[model samples]
Target: MGTHRPRGETARRSRTLSGQIARVLPLLPLAHLDREFDYLIPPEFDEIAKPGVRVRVRFAGRLVDGFLLERVESSDHPGKLGKLDRVVSGEQVLTPEIAELARSVAARYAGTRADVLRLAIPPRHARVEAEERAAPVPIPEVQRDDGAWQRYQHGPAFVAALADGKAPRAVWQALPGEDWTLRLAELAATVVARGQTAVLVVPDARDLQRLAGACTQRVGAVVALAADLGPAVRYRRWLAALRGDAKVVVGTRSSVFAPVSNLGLTAIWDDGDDNHAEQRAPYPHAREVALLRAHESGAACVVAGYARTAEAQALVASGWAHDLVAPRATVRECAPKISAPGDSEQALDRDPNARMARLPHVGFVAARRVLAAGDPVLVQVPRAGYVPGLACASCRTQARCRRCNGPMAVAASQAMVCRWCGVTDPAYRCSACGGQRMRATAVGARRTAEELGRAFPGIQVVFSGGAEVLDAVKPGPKLVVSTVGAEPVALGGYGAALLVDGWTLLGRPDLRAAEEALRRWMAAAALVRPDGEVIVVADPGVPAVQALIRWDPVWHAELQLAERAEVRFPPAVRVAALDGSEEGIVSLLGLAQLPADTEQLGPVPLPASSPDDHEAVRLLLRVPRSAGSALARSLAAAQAARSARKIDAPVRVRIDPIDIG
Candidate 1:
């Protein structure tokens, strides 16, 4: 100890210094990487380098973002590694639950974890330019003598159980009309009143607006997160929820991820709408996301619509949720009187209503009565323009743009414009035949509106669709022509509704065509006054039309379920649609590890108007109910392997796809 050999030499020889010199800090792998990299944890962040949090690091000569998927005690390249720059934020953005959910979704969809995270959470650095104001007013307690509240009283207890963070499943059916929206608002309010957060998702912006308005009245302040909000405003709303300034969030599909503290409930309206499916990468559907959130947060989950989807029905049948439906008598009392074209006792002698018919007699009579009574009537059309497609007047050949084979629309000056590619041609001819004359075969909303204007002169006909028509619509005793999804009548209600062209809806080359058509019919029917009439212009013999005639959606759902069970369609057996080039698909089929007894329906050619194009073909696979999940996992794994092999073709796998042709 006397005259310890040079202090520096002793310090260097000490274990702490030697240990630091030999220590190799492990790198946290990013969500997306061809291979993991070696990174050293900086001494400053060593304590904070917990897995699942974001970290800044130098990689490939640049500082880039990365997620800490795991922490390791040592690295392979202990000598040639740079220390992590810093932890991005102390707050944990990716909780263990959220990380697992994203991972599961990525695996199920054959997508990257980063891609799934991108969908689940908004950009962390994107700041909303707004001062934190007072928090939104708490949801008001609603007291009602009606039986509706009798059910709502139990909502708090249900939500309290969910707050324990266990997936509590429940099915709620509202008596059609404003009541459905109100009941949902009340349930959300009860959750909020308990100092917990809530997320309410609807299928479309209009529905979001409606629900938001209802919630705003009951709950003093709420954040409406939707795509319609300009980027800055949307960011502000998102941040409000993130900062715990807003407890109630109402929005469309993207709002499922709204950061509501202490999430007690996650509710989705019309969970079956295809619009609820995110079109972006990872392609998570709102229903699936809601389910995942419920499971993760131990929140009460409720799926409500005017009519339940087969998926929802399956949930009830499987005992995953309780079916909260209005009593049969209550439903019958509120449902409108339904008239169908197929009623033999009241069949129209005039030309039988066909898919291509302009206006069915029953619908026409209803429209006339409603208009004459000084009330506005809604006329729902399947198509949206004056002429979405054109055919030859002489040879019945379809009119298509020669440039892109897109459907051509005729504008002023007799100009033909391709709706798809927007190519205009002054001189257009039918490609099927060298013909110039074109005929409009089917009626669209625009054409129907025009016809109604002329048929009922001085009656103020209004048209609504993809184009700007909301401003043009006014309260009046006239006809309101609209596309199935674009109906513009206000919430006050319409005198009557005419569901035209049932054949067009039922005959679609899609698996859920019937279900979708019935949903539309029910939506429009819900808009009519309870005493008003609903005329469905179709053969009452058809089960769908018959269900409408009886005003029984449950019957329709049960029948469809039975039929699907018999045919092994969705809700009975899990189905997957794999679409890709013929060769790629064939390879997938060849490599597929489907379970025994799983049926392979087709390598069927996709229906393209042209025969030369063979890039898209669909293979339908039906897995036994017990093996569906496994099959889906296997298909996703196979796709990932194919991608890793550097396959040049594209392969898409859709589980429980909405449309199956």
Candidate 2:
């Protein structure tokens, strides 16, 4: 319990008010401090102190900022209430819809309302809001059917439903190299044609730029919102949406919460991308947020991705959303020809020399043929460095730094570098075999580019990775060596592609290792023309590789969902991760009063790059999906109890954390 102010009685009697104000203090989300407290509205400040307005109040004997939720005629308290200190902003930044959504998100994630509100509402920019707000502008018509959307079975119907004011939910599996921006623009235009607004949320700024272009082409122009914008600019954009000035908003993750009036549709591009997950407390995912918004606003929902996640599949399976995918023949026609390790037996037999090299001789032949036809070739590598990981030449023991036990790799000038602790060793020796010689365990893009440069002789080698990324490459006889997301888009699509180091990507310890690898491969392969060939140096027997070769992400997602269900992993079951001091976690669990059926795992130390004075461990709590809300409530209750008792020792809670480990 908080301490009562000595002058509280006097302060209450100093003001005569018609109503009490429900205000929530803007403090760090300490559980017990989460609720709203009643304050007597001073007669002079009565007009300004209203719901959704920012106010200052005295809390725990200190002045703090808060948002006024509502004003009521009277309070249920037997004791008199303290008067509101002052009004901060009369402009209602926190709209009723957004406030409710924030509350729901907080409850769902076992997070404090204040923390969720912090993320939901941006900093108050008075100047920006005071400026003349823009109004929704009329949009031009866009071409609907032009080979862009004809591939999907439900593509036309999805657009029609939005235009007809029918709230349709769909899980769209976009074809490789398909124009998602164009597709999203068409949907927005359909909604606009019906005199309604739409909110489109993508994973990153690049996606935002592309979607913005599409929206501009189809629906005139749209308001853009993202974290990278200056505070004033971001707030102005948000205000436009809140004021119904913008009918359509295209942006990154935060755009899901954009207050577009009469929202007819909410779309998320690449829901599987990790960028969609908020890093703040509550950690709401964009896809789930959009779904919630769609349901609340009676708007249509669209979740599209190149590679589907199990969660999205669950939505389709549960009939909550229809699966919008291209027909078999269309997919086969659009997808590049894929050849896995076993599938390339004929090519290897034709050229024995190709099998002897890492790049593969068949890949060389394909490169030559594509270059002759004046098309660039994209080579995808798993890493970007001279040498990413190394091992002892004699015994194959993984090279590690002696000081920090971090995995060691060779940097420029043959100097050994630690991937974890940044330690360096010029004269490193093997611990197991006492051998000084080292071997490359995994080759990186830079090294791969070097090898290819020599093999291909005079042809230009364009390296794209790290900081230097190319937006779009011109059609030429060039070899573009890039790592995963950094792969440059060729002007006319790559003539051929080489997906190397598949084993390195799939062998990561993370749960989504194989799934993510397939996604990366698919993204790169999608850049290749339909007539182009994609040579993957991975065993065809692997499910991920087979899925890639067959161009069936849906099948792979289904298989993954089944596997997760069997193991009781997320999407099958709801999970929460609590990371903190061992003592703090144990205390929290004891007081949490979680569901009886909830399963708890670990107090295991977190994997750290360097030794710490105080060890940090994490606790995982899982319950059946049906009882998810119950679990969250119980945890929240426990947190509140801890805060009330002043027992806070710093515990971090994350719901549906991306990295489960």
Candidate 3:
């Protein structure tokens, strides 16, 4: 039989041992051009022209930045190849696994690999890179037997599975009063004991700080990665993870891609937190990325949160992961007593003033009692400003600016400011009824504090939100009014919590409004002492309120998952949203090939801010979970093909957008 070489092999081999280069061109992030280009490596620069090294390449008659992905002995290209300009850096900042991950993430979100790489790796800082390397500090080993894990039904098995390198997947339902940071640290230590690395990704810096402290308490040291740190410190921490010097990495969203060598476990805290979602292209959620990394690297996965997301519940439903939850008695013991006055019609009838009052008389009385007992009272508000919106007092009509017709709002010093156009009107007349008087339509944290301060003259009123958010507060008999997601932790848990304007939070147009509201409520409530009380101003009969009253987030999440499945929404299925000029979006959708069972809705016109602005449309495409990968691949291919033809009119394609509205 005649000897045959592998496909794409050159029949006439080069005697010079010519090297092929996979150049990651730093050009416009066009879908069609989102791939590596083949280049010939010159003989002199052959040693430096390797994969994972940044290089300057001559493309389109200009020197552009690029990353060399791979080197080969031959090329299949019929045309003459351009030689690499020069090697930019010897440091392999783009590791092989990360490069592969970037590509995979790009394809998954129908985005260009370059865009994903931009977020994956920060800009190269020569000074930071040249700094002397310090030996990674060793962390103390945690006890093999943990008393906390024993309290949960499947926590011990989950810990054991990870420690034994079984690569188990779990959705940890965090108990209200439990120390999740310590629990997560214990899990990381167990994985480290197996001689494997672990990654813990939280939602923000506050959580990162707490988790880092937990790691220090359990282990000797932890590599914390956060944007708030100086560039030098942040880069050092990142390098530690890349060089495998850091066995345990704790950070926010970006740390999900930390190049920990031999990753054994990846855990995300509060997966439902909007902060976990990457705002850049590809927009990969931290939970999804961790799950993907775990799957690819054979690492165990843990998605833990007080209130789980529907997406996580979907994973448990498919048997892809197990639910690790505490017993009912344990939850009850840890959770505070919860009540909803709106749930009972008799309670509403007995005190009609409490129904519309921001701080109902009953709630005010409860707060006063809690303050009298020398304990802090936490009041959760929905907005942050003094008065976010205003309306005409006489006709109760929304006040708008004459210049832009934008809603008028209260700025500093009771000034009437147009929120949209930034026009200030100290003396303005209402366009609707020619009324000069203006009143607030929505109450904010500052306004709530102002009123509460007057109501309780002797007690102190502390504000905890907006530009000045606090991480921790002293335990005192004070009223701390904070907006959602900005509630500060008390030294000891707050004695009482009042959740005000629950309707404003739950009545949003978004699909996850109730889910998000429940999460916010639970997060605030979790800060209350076990013996304390949480009074919700919403109706008790509502599912979200009931969930809070019963302290059963798992039930709420499961119910949400079921509802989404019935309605063919996300998590139950995969969804992608396309947005752009009406014609551009329509054309892209038409050109793209989708799965056979794909269902599509819209080309629906989206509301424009001004009449002069161009009208944009949105399209939502759905496919079964099994077909998600196929659909993503098809969309990426279509986009790449379109980009290749230079047909770009600026259409945005996002997969599983959190704000579908």
**Reference-based TM-score of each model:** 0.79, 0.87, 0.87
Clashes of each: 3, 1, 5
Please give the distance, in angstroms, between residue 125's alpha carbon in candidate 2 and its true position after superposition. 2.0
Tens-digit lDDT track of model 3 for 1-661: 0011234544554333245544455545666656567677767777766678888877677777778887766554544667777788777888887887877787778787788887777677778778787766776755887578888888888888877788999999888877789899999988887788899999999899999988877765469998688877888788878777788899999899887788889999998888988988778888888888888888899999888789988888889999998899999998998987745678778786565555677788789889999999999999754342465666444576676454566665787866434568988887768899976645688888998899899899889887888998898899999999999999988999999978666654355877998999999999999999999887566799999998888888899998878867788889888778877776677778899999876555555668886577677788998999888888887777767777767677889888763
Give the per-residue lDDT digits (tens) of candidate 2, residues 1-661.
1123232244333333365545445555568777667787878887877788888888768888778887766554546678888788788777887787787888888887788778777888978867875644766765556366667897777777776799999999989888778888888988888888899998877778878888877887488888999999999888877777677899888788886678899999878788999998878898888888888888899988888888889998899999999998999989998986445567557655442356666677888999888889999998754343466676555576686454566666778866544457888999878899987656778988999999889999999988787778888899999988888878878999999877666655345766888888988998988999999877566899999999999999999889878767779999898888888888888888788899876554565546654467777788999999999998888888888888857788888787773
Q: Candidates' lDDT values, in order?
A: 0.68, 0.79, 0.79
lDDT of 1 by residue, 1-661 (tens): 0011122232332222211111211122222241234455667776667765667776556676756655555443323446667777654555555666776776555456666767666655434433545655655674432446444335444545553444467766555454566777776776666677889999887777778887888776688888777767776777678667787899998888776668888999987688898877657788878887887677889988876677777877788887666566766777778877547643645544432354666667777888888778888888753332466665444566565344566765678866434467888876656788876645567777888788778888777778554522455687888888777754456878888766667655355767788888887788777778888876567777776666666677777787778767777988777777878887766666877878775564554547777557677778767887688767766766676666667777777677663
Q: How many angstroms is residue 47 displaced in model 1 relative to the true structure, after the best TM-score fit? A: 7.8
In the order shown, the candidates' Cα RMSDs to the true structure are 9.9, 6.7, 7.5
Off by over 4 Å in 3: 1-28, 345-349, 352-356, 385-441, 607-612
Residue ranges of candidate 2 with Cα displaced over 4 Å: 1-28, 134-136, 141-147, 344-357, 385-441
In angstroms, how far off is 181's CA in candidate 1?
2.3
Candidate 1 regions with alpha-carbon error over 4 angstroms: 1-38, 44-53, 56-64, 69-82, 85-91, 124-126, 129-146, 149-168, 346-357, 385-441, 469-474, 589-592, 607-613
Score candidate 3 by TM-score against the native.
0.87
